[model samples]
Target: MDKEEYKEERFTERCDDKVESIGGDYDLEEEDDSPVEEVRVTISNTDDPSMPCNTFRMWFLGLIFTAIVSFVNQFFYLRQTQISIGYSVVALVSLPMGHFMARVLPTEDFNLLGWKFSLNPGPFSIKEHILIGTMTAVNTSTAYAVDIVILQKLFYHSEKPFIAGLLLVFTTQVTGFALAGALRKFLIRPAHMIWPSTLVTASLFRSLHAGNNAPGDEGRMTRMKYFLLVTLGSFIYYWFPGFIFPTLGVISWICWIDPENVVLSQLTGSNGLGIGTIALDWSAASYYVQPLVTPWFAQVNILIGFILVAWIMVPWAYYTNLWNSKDYPILSPDLFREGGEAYNLTMILTKNVLDEKKYEAYGSVRMDSFFALTYGVGFAGLTATVVHVILYNGKEMLARWRSARLENEDIHSRLMRVYPEVPDWWYISLFVTSITLSLITCIVWDYMPWWAVLLAMVIAIFFVLPVGIVQAVTNQQPGLNIVTEYVIGYMLPGHAIANVTFKTYGYIVNVQALTFTADLKLGHYMKIPPRIMFMAQIISTLISGVINLSTATWLVETRPKVCTKDGYPFTCRNTNTFYSASVIWGAIGPARVFGNVQGAIYSPVQWGFLVGALLPIPFWLLARHFPNVTWLKYVHWPVLLAATSNMPPALPYFYTNGLFIGFVFAFLLRRYRYNWWARYNYLTSAALDTGVAICGLMIFFCIQSWDGEMPAWWGNPSDKNYDHCPLGAANYYGVIS
Candidate 1:
């Protein structure tokens, strides 16, 4: 049987008799692959007797947590160690806070004209907590446009008006949210379109509400107890790797044995490519690919591709001296020249515009071979997603479109049919409002021409559907940033600010759209009214955008050298990487990097798109022609390419760590210990993630931000703190070959 058929069988195998008994009230086949052993669960059953949604308490709690999560997330964004609340910590805390409001506040409802408002209507419903969590999740991370603003200020020494920056952030973020709302009919209403991550959140909600009055919920009670134990254990265990005993996180035995060997350090160190390393830290393991979010099949594809690229390809290319790799750091996002000096971006850039005279004198920009290869892989990954979508999911998408038009009897859609949808006009109004703001912000700041802003919005609108389809189907978002930059670089060369402006609008708009759509689905699953979901998302998003932009501007103005090597916890690693991207794709333009004659040094990487487009055809043919070879089904080329795309920010051990955990939890435990896997797999992920976030937050507030240091000890070695790799440590000083 094919994978889909196998999954269907697994889903129905144990529930045949119960499914027949439940009849129309419950559809076993339509449920998500949930660990909850309930045989008859129905998405269309929205018969709720609980408190009404959109109560005043829901909005109150959402605003409070919005400020809290926004502060924490933006604070961490500038830290050397990148961390965010994401969803787990917020969910963990919000569950109790939501219940507290429900219990403590008065249940009296007051009428204002024809509308009713209440501090508390009754019991704190699960829907209330879901709304709070969804809104909080929206606020936790700085939107993508803030990165562009910070890059311009920190690296290029350029700044925009405060109003312009705020407006840009809001427009880019909400534009996507609006577009996602537009795609709700296509992406959110289907029962079969289950987001695996959403299932974990739903299960957590159930566990939280599993009170003692239930007669036949012993299993749920036990699961709740198990969750508490694991969460406490995880919280305590995290201290070893996160703070006091840092070496435990990066136990590179090979690095310890041969500490000064450049090649060995590069091969085995966590900070380097980490080719043959072991990360004892769960935080490190989940950094690249979250264990709870990614499914086993997806993880398998990533593992195979990582082995081929990080393990085999990178080491060979570096050791063999491809692209003059020996003269530069084995892995970094920084740029250099042929003579092994840090590329003098200042000399080449006059007032943030590339100086042709200085650039020609400085010679061609030299990228570390592997870093360049990632861009190649990224392009290939982008192309592969389009091809893969066309080949694999085309029919599925067509069926969904037909079902959507027919107002099909899919369980989730049927459940949602009761509520009044936030009309299409609402989404259109938001889109139109955001685009006008975007155009005004860009033109006012001279960030980009008015026409470029229009072009960007057009690009964003065009790609959101195709990209949204991939994310809705596969849970992977193939970014448009690279492709968008390629277009702007060629169209409006030598205009760095405009280049970033266009790229942000074109790229981040789609990302926000998908994110908003996901939250809408979460709301749909929990039966939160659609209008309430829209309000909560938009309100929280706008407030968070303002706060994030303000925070970013303050840091840039106050801490001038934030991304420097010595900045430590304030290194602004992501910002520096963003700056590098702006310089490469914006300042230099595609002509200098990819031109056949003018830029022969790096032009070859452009063929990656063609290579990526072609790579998946063979896999599809093999699967088609050899129907019995089930292993062929596992070979998803797009996923493999996407895994390689994680190389820069994620350490080399990331893929390996994902593979290890997938083997233990997803493969072995899921098969042999099915009940245990169902009960604890996602719970463990939540616990570990929350533990790390809590630890990191405490350490940052208590020690790092105050300029207090942990006392020097053997466990916290100065020679090598977290990563044992030191070969490229001096690259920050510009001491090249």
Candidate 2:
């Protein structure tokens, strides 16, 4: 059924309620605040004529699956971070969660699995399992690759061990979860907010529940066709890379293809896209979906981001010859200096010594430094974003609040539900925690100045809103806080060179728009107290911060060869890792004459104002001149769930590990969502994820914590040898002179 019909049908009580007590028959009551309709769902055992079977098998399976998820989530292997653990584990756990949810939920009847299906028109609703399973898969799979890993790691310049570096991500997702929980009713029931991702998941459940008339089946043969599609799709993906279409998407003609190029080389080596844990992260939000049909929005996003970053940003740097090679300046590759530092023009890395020592430098950033900024932004701008969101969206929120309060009266009366409200103390504690932790990090390491520490916080506060939300749109995330960092850099006592420029007003605006895409997703599925989610994220931030540092130190210490190496092998060039880069850029403003306070504010991102001002002129002109083409409709944001890469890939790579997690589960569960197996799917997903997360954390402590790669020198691996220098801090600045 289409969305409206589905809601109409769903709201009307029928065969069974997933959580019947709370979700009373929508058709039965149409009161603005119907007491019965508000009853919350809970699990309860159905009357079983026979004894429950396989207790030992269930326990054993759960334990094994949980262990696998834990290991995978906690460790990094190959190029993949273990975030896939969530979907994979959840796929397995769905079995138990489904059984439990089914048992507890008040259903008119019960349906068992496997052989039991034929006994009595299927006692355990296969439909329920399918729905829940697909949702579980969607929640874990799409969110990570589309939102977190791709955006942060690839587009926004997030840390490799993002766990160690930034707070915004952990904070945002957790907050979204909590807020979504509280805000779900309004978003889902009547307001018409298209929770697109969740809808796909819900469809799966409906299908599974259909006894013979399951959703998505044109007929038994049509359903048979789906099984065939899966077989063919799976076989082609598995074999094509090793045997046939190796670089599936690439131009096989080879004439236009730059076979020698690193990116091209990597793609050439790519195992044709299948159920890969190996992510091709274009941004934290970038995903490797082989959509049979690409939407204009996604196509536009990729095209726009590519044009701006490649055509504008790269060229601007090249023209300036930052590498100092007037004859032949290199713009993109990594170069090592005897002294560990950002690619400075002065540093020579053997550029045809016979002819010239010309070299071009690349910019580097520290994760700690950036986090300091993000933390500051989270502190200051978070308030602004939240306040603005609430205030601007207040009327809607109030109505929702009132509606849920009334509707939930029946559910509360029945069950001892645990809808805990996150308190004021939690937020206050977070503020204090951020302050204390940052100070501890800085003072203990002595890597930056008190002013810089203050500056970092100041940095994060200024950029958080613009950076976060805009990223939600444009399918692009500019690192170095494209707008705020530039403004701050230009305005600072030094750093006004405009060394990095946010390019093209059209695309920059697009990029900036994608920031809140994750929040939008959370706004759909969850019903937890917003305040609680917000607080939980802050708490997660604290945990992530501590872990970030430990991991970063290991990466630096283990390899001891950073910028000097060819590619920034891991998340080495991350903002937090190059905290010192902040100072480097900060000192540039006073160096430039025109970069005074006013001059600083006049930099690029301020173009937001220009665009805001002039955008309407063209818009009105378009409507008048070419009424057929609505230019505004073409604008797209990367932050949408369709685009947002929140958790699918990243979660598996950290904080969780379990044996049962696997890529196929995510794909299979999603494909079968409309089957009878849908209902218990989501519950199973949650269980699997939880199990894997627990195991992943344990694995982190066992292997990752103790056996991590340690840095050899105090500087980037190539230039400075720590063997000669003290184990403490060493300045690569000595080599520059």
Candidate 3:
């Protein structure tokens, strides 16, 4: 039997765990492969008068936590909503949602009991929630952290003002959700990717559901305990930095202390490590990344991320000749007419006014060259993905069929443990639902065109799907930013300059990357209905959008000083990050005239891709036996080499991140698990981050107000009288580090 059939058998019989009799309300099947044991989950007891009470408490707690997190994020950034609330809440709340969803849609009905609270069956079970939530949350967080922090803040410094920032986040996320909605059925279901995250989350939910159903054991030991821990842990994590100390976060800057850096440091130009306010704790969390432990393996893990990034950046510098200090001097001189690192360093000078000089960056090319690459990769990935699917996973698909044919026995758990394996039809319906919703949303929001919505769906179907799959397979995303940029370039047709239409669509690409990666991760976890998971993300994101809008509205009207003069909404962590990247990248994209001026020089990806394709050609000649040194590895090696060349400083950030991952891995993977590390470490880390970030943001807001103390103190004279001032200013939120 293939994997699907094997899984079905395991879930049915010859497996041992739940000790309750499911009676006729359940179904079972046995596979010859192993000893059979029944795994039962208790459906909520609808008959009990207290059923509503249980649900009320669970959902009530969930909403409270969400609100609290939103409040904290708002206070720090001066805008609430779109708050992460950490993955734990995402994980915890998902279970309830999953169970509730199953009941509303399930094919069968049954009743079951838990410790103190009995679970009722609508359709599926809590297990689905756990697996789905876990998978999606990880990738979402990963994509959020890596892309937002690095690309946004480090790369593009968005400059639309506070309200604009809110709009940007809202628009982009909605676009992604809409796109995911379009592709959910085609890619999510039937593929049975068994997204790792969804599976595990589902497992956790099953444990809870089953434990509740057991005669002697009730929800008391299970639901109450876990729920309390999650809440207590979440609260403590939020306040830890405030009450106790701070946690630090980091990014790498080889040029900061590099002597070469000082060489480029022109009194009139933006120079030096370009590092100052970012590293130290925001309030208590070190703005600078710091880790408690540096494990042997973490070094390797960080090296991997660094390698990919460096390969794209460093070699291009060498090949393009940007590394030579005496050559171009892009960093020095009164670079920006309006100053500000965003205006000064970026290829395009979008400052107080469109600095004409910045737009003239690329030599013969416009900045967005990646569009062609994306188009090419999309085509290639699409063809290969389909073929691979048919070849590699075809057996399992057939087995699911055979199991269905042989007996109507294989189905959703009696107590709704796993959600009924979602059928493809559901996914298709979700796509249609989203398309219609997006159109409705567009009309209501007046943010996008009707045709634009249709085109986005097409793009999602053809391009984003392929990219999402690749990201799932190898933790790397072939982001379509360049592709979309090019599309915008052509459709919006910026006659010599980037236009508004381009800018509008550009936001969607950013959202697409964020959404795709999150979904991939989510699917990896719970085995939740990709269709449903897709819908949930949309629902949650929409909720986030509303929150962002309301907060931004509040900030704009009441705290207009902070919103405009102070960069209230604009400076919120990830908001600024993406804006920065989009502008910088837009400059470099092939579509922009000067985008490629230094392309061969500074673009690691450009040279890396070329180098990757060509590197192996020569390696084959160098050693006949070195077949392993082929293109993929060859291309990857340079990226790796470039990544680690600037390693040591960035080490702290990656190591700390890994400390959590390691803690999780160690606790989870080690047969005899130390439950405490598994449970509390994540909570502790979350608390540490919340406290630190909150403090820093609040301080930043205060300092920016320059209410009296540091108004003039933040002023600087050398860098074009730009008044860049202390790091917390509208120009230097980077200094919040």
TM-score of every model versus the real structure: 0.88, 0.44, 0.54
Which pairs clash inside model 1?
80-569
Model 3, span 656-702: residue lDDT tens: 34434444444343335444443344334444454444444454455
- Between candidates 2 and 3, which one is better according to lDDT? 3
- Candidate 1 ranges beyond 4 A from true positions: 1-44, 110-116, 189-207, 210-229, 407-411, 414-417, 554-560, 719-724, 728-737
The lDDT values for all models are 0.73, 0.31, 0.36
Candidate scoring better on TM-score of 1 and 2: 1
Best by TM-score: 1
**TM accuracy, model 2:** 0.44
- The worst-scoring run of ten residues by lDDT in candidate 3 lies at 42-51
lDDT of 2 by residue, 1-737 (tens): 79767543332222211223435433323233212221112111111112221122222333343334323332222122223444323433455454564455443433355221111222343332332232222223211111223223332333344332343233322332322333333332332233243334334333433455555544444332333344344334423221122222222222224423322222122211011122222111112322211233454443453334333443353335322211121221222232334434223213201112232232221111111222222223223333433333446545544553454433222221222334546545544554555454434433233454455444444444344432222223434333444445544433211111111111222222222223333322333223323433333333433333344344444633332322222332222222222333333331221233322221232233333333334434455567677765444322121121211122211111111122223334446653433434343433323433344344446544475533333222233221112211111111221
Best-to-worst order by lDDT is 1, 3, 2
Q: Compared with the true structure, what per-residue lDDT tens digits does model 1 show for residues 1-737? A: 99766443332321111112222343336343332233124233444412356667677888888887787678778865455666766666666677787778887656678554466666677777788889988776687888878877777777777787888899989998888877876777755556555665676776666675556555464654665677678778877776788877777777777767766776777767675577777766776677655778888888878877777777787778777777777777788888667876888878878888888887778877778888888888888878887888879877755755564445555555545678899999998998888888887788889989889888988988767666766676788888789999989877777888899998888788888888887787776777778888999998998888887777667664677766655777777777777777778887887775355477878888999999989988899999999998878878898787756656677667767887888888999998767667776777776666677778767876687676667767665456655653323222433
